[model samples]
Target chain A: MADAKVIPFDDDRSRGGGAQRPVRRRPASGGRRKADAAAVRDAALSPLPGPQTGEAGPGPDAGPAAPAEPVRGARSAASGASGDAGGAGDAQQDGAPVTAAGETPVTADGGWDRRIAGGLAFLRRRITGDYEVDEFGYDAELTDHVLMSMLRPMYQKYFRVEVKGIENIPSEGGALVVANHSGTVPLDGLMLQVAVHDNHPADRHLRLLAADLVFMLPVVNELARKAGHTLACAEDAERLLQRGEVVGVMPEGFKGIGKPFSERYKLQRFGRGGFVSTALRAGVPIVPCSIVGAEEIYPMIGNAKTLARLLGFPYFPVTPTFPWLGPLGAVPLPTKWTIQFGEPIPTDGYPPEAAEDPMLMFNLTDQVREQIQHTLYKLLVQRRSVFF
Target chain B: MGKVVLVTGVARQLGGRLVRRIQRDPEVDRVIGVDAEGPGHHLGGAEFVRADIRRPAIARVLAEHAVDTVVHLDVTGTPLGAGGRTAVKETNVIGTMQLLGACQKSPTVKRLVIKSSTSVYGSAPRDPAVFTETTPPKSLPSGGFAKDAVEVEGYVRGFARRRPDVAVCVLRFANILGPCADSPLADFFSLPVMPTVFGYDPRLQFVHEDDVIDVLRIALHEPRRGTLNSGTFNIAGDGVLTLSQCSRRLGRPTLPLLLPAVTWVGSALRTVGFTDFSPEQIRLLTHGRVVSTVQMRETLGFRPKYTTAETFADFARSRGPGLLPPETLAEAVDRVAAALSIGVLDGAPVEDGGPAVTQTTHSSGQPG
Candidate 1:
């Protein structure tokens, strides 16, 4: 009964809306599954005693041993089956289930033998009815353990990401995370997801609002859904906010991701500030996020126009290495990435009716865009080099 | 004061049981149970009168009984009770038309409760994340009970317009499942090998039969006097489960079928004699549908006793297990695997579980 909270009208928009995290904390089992899933994924990805036989590659064609997404959401319904979550602390003997080495499961689930065994165990549980996904197809067990681990190597060692002003991220409740988008491919969004999860004070998961194209690709679509990225629509965003999730949005979309290398870091129009009206309607704050060094990851020099149209991509990016170096060129350059979270722009003060005002929306959109641009400039100035 | 009550479809188990339940209440003087064919079960403390609601004779029955309250339960979604497609449509659409015609003329009929289905909210690729009470369905149901429900709700809305004095309550119930309640979803879940679309596992919601009866009783007992009460509501237990989760819990292995091959599977199911396994049902299995019950709780003032998981669990319990024991070697292995999973999962979080991780306790403590 306590958590049956309808969207309260009396949002204390004053910055001192302190420590509202208790009412806003996600249901423990769901949170724990994600935390645990990510934990498992981390263990699996970490280098072990054996050779690196199968690392998940980072290209349009990721290897067969790609970062795992569940057959189900790894979320929503099945993963929320916290009925068995309390038994989480019972064993340390999973690592050598086949060999009976009696070593802990940390090394066990990570090893190649244990990898196949762990995957089988996961599959067996799914078939036998232990794993469940929530409505959104989110299996925290899958996302944290499988999807996140797949993205972690690129996030941690490759990019060598530096995050700043994470405390500016409100600890709880809904806040619209507005960020600049760039690169021939939008790896920035994925890196930001990793950054938020790894850096935020609460280790809160960022539900990125993605475009339809992301959900159109078969494997890519499923992985995006499992990782908590939803369709970039107002209805979806409002639902996430109402449930107290920190929503991430990149307004530039294809325009940001498909820009010429010459125009990189130059802010594009914020799509008429639809994201602002979403925040206004939901009565949440807007946190401006500035991502630096994503521009050089894939420098788009020219567009292979016919090829792009043939393949249904916005543009076929002609980076210096791409189409020349072939498959290997699809791998991103290890640019030094720095993500800064600026102070939040409060939207709760306005009445819900204000979302209807175009002029007001335009101004608020400008306010958010200006804040992000300023931060991007500041961070860019502070950077020593492109690759660090 | 007690009101004279008339209940339709008393031939069905739900209507029959409802009539008996209402008869015990001191708020009624007489109970007129109308059905074309009487159920084999006894209807104590109530009068059973054979009447075809689709025919004009229903108006005579309504006037003769002076029925002050009407509980229309004959809008059957499946052919199991309604016979054929035409017959189900007639009972759902034409029968509702005739019943509404009768109620319109009868000055005594001041309160109306029509049982509707959430199937009216058809499944589609481009639907809203959640359907509130007022959200127009994405794809309207085409030749099934779902379509009939849409038309039935339309007529009820029309009736509300013509006779503002009458209290019209339209309940859009989710797939109803319980031990004794038989419906299409129940039949499908009851199958040994449930066939599902290969790549999709849509979200599912359900309302227990007990909750359905309880809400119906609440509707008849507590009449609303305000503006918001007359509107439609989506009824389902809290939380949701995927198609995979439901089949797994039911202990039925799902045979994944490709998209184009799904209709054949549906026809195969129908040939095997499942009533709700039409093309519309195929769409539901593929996309799945969910409706918000905020109106059900905040405005309608009734909370389901069972959450989604608990409701499905009840159905699974009632259905019992298949060839295996309740606890199998697989389950025993899972318990160990789950324990291993938790330990491995919790290990990484220990390093990441900074001061913020403990903040949940701190915040809960702050309030204290």
Candidate 2:
């Protein structure tokens, strides 16, 4: 195996006010050099946090020896060469082929060693500094490469989602995606995100505005953040739209997700049209997204209200197979899915101040809800069977 | 050549250095340096006035100097030259109160530049994603220098209300990091082994001490008018670095302390000489704090030369290793003996019978 290259990320800036030092290029796969550089570089420029290691412990006389002066000047004086790669996101991106997966620059059209090397390089990039995430903690590289790869099979082969009106979504610019939320487990949202990214020619990522509960959980929160789901608030939506990113919102929130199997396809209140106002303010279009087949995924037959209350969940759903067949009951019914994106409701036509008018907001909200409900009824009539 | 500046706490590194910078500026005629004690470093040709700002006589110094511009750099998070917490509070709060009172009365004092800390925006769980200048902290600082800073800003606001003519520019600086900077945060980062709250990797922000000097100079030389000048602005380098990422980069491994016993970790570290891990800082470590610099760019018209990450990296660049591992030095005698004797052998009662706290001087593993 060849020794990886170590580059000084910011040679001049990390040197403090001192003159630039020589950039070390070790060829013997000095792996620690990268981690050391990464760790040290990051810390060298950081505000040395207080914990004045005064060289004297808590002895009666040691207190004064811990003068604030030595503590301030000591560590910074210790930095030197290690400071250059401090803040680079890819500093420790050495060793594992994980981070370099994005820019491997190697082809597989070769012998076994070449193939292994190419594979290693890709893995290295994937694990290291090769990925880019937005300020909201959404990793574009991961979603495009890893996440979509895993979900694409289900989106196309398993559930067989047939997306319509992909042309209705603008190729570029800030837009709001208001979709119906369903499927007892709410696979619809993830499917919708995949739908936009894979179906669209430009392949733009969707920033989903999720409820606070999603972020409150431990593992779910991290995955959700990396998947680009921010708090479902007007502020977050507006910011996303302002950044020219496509934002998806299911304003129905918990009500839409926890509703009984009977009222499955019914559209819940759009939460006072906050998404509409966000679109209006940003002067962007609102694409009404309708997903059919999700409601049947987990037919909500009953509710464990007491258990949900005790467990702090919005609602504990009891599907026909769930809670009775144990874990196997949890598997989603492979219902054929049809996702139809309707004509974009142009919020740009209204004045920016129109977002402020409650009457207008209510009317616009109703219009969107009516459009989605009407589409749901039409799609239901066109559908053949649940599993077909 | 127009602004006659009066700099408080000239004995400190930032204040002392700023005084020298002000003296070189062709924009000013006279610069008066005020401190309780004389400056440790030479201030070239700047006049020194030995006076305690906590005392009423500071008003006399302000009036006598005919100081048109006042730069308050005396507020500190840690009691460095000052004796204890009581003294730090007096210097920070009482000093700022008296100085503001003096500025209110001083008819010539038109511009007041206050060097504040972002600690005013207390680190709490429910804090906004990014705090603007106006967002109130979810939980106010209950103790430590953060509380003192919050109080100091309040007094400054009161002064601003009384003296509407004075263009007061309050800069809420993030943790100031530089080779020569001594802050509570500096001491924490410089520790041989960092003890982080378990399961938390709070984002940290910082302003280079050099940037701090520059921004103060900007506020002093060119004070913005109306609400822009009077309004408080958050000053920090762009972007942030998380705690674990920082520890990893610094070659310092972290001991994840359970949340409830965080204070105990502070005391344990203190016994081992890593002092100054206050409750407020612990909270900060638990949940990182970040502020927006949009106002600093648009209103204050100062773009930081270093981002938060860059400032930290520079600070890290100048630090000497707390303890060098035996393997790193090739010309050493018996590497095995050096390693076994100091560690991986019989553990002594920790250099001077202090508690055997986690001492990870350079146990960052092969970095691989």
Best by TM-score: 1
In order, candidate lDDTs are 0.70, 0.68
Candidate 1 lDDT tens digits, A47-160: 221223432122122222123211111211222323222122111111112212223234323433333334444544444545555556666655554566566667655776
Every candidate's DockQ is 0.09, 0.02
Across B219-282, the per-residue lDDT of candidate 1 in tens digits comes to 7665545324456888899887778668767766677777778788788767766646888888
Instruction: Name the regions of candidate 2 deviating beyond 4 angstroms.
Output: A1-133, A145-162, A183-187, A296-313, A316-336, B36-40, B81-87, B122-128, B136-143, B192-203, B223-230, B243-248, B251-258, B261-275, B279-283, B320-368
- Chain A in model 1: its TM-score? 0.70
- Pick the DockQ winner: 1
lDDT of 2 by residue, B1-368 (tens): 37789999898888989999889888899999999988889987999999999999999998887899999999987665647678988999999999998898889998999988898889754455567888788789999989999999999988988988888889999989999987877888788877777655566788998898888888887654531555789999888766654654554556776766878888776566456888898978766777888899988888999987678778777775434322232213224334433221121111111011111111121111
| lDDT, model 2, position B235 | 93
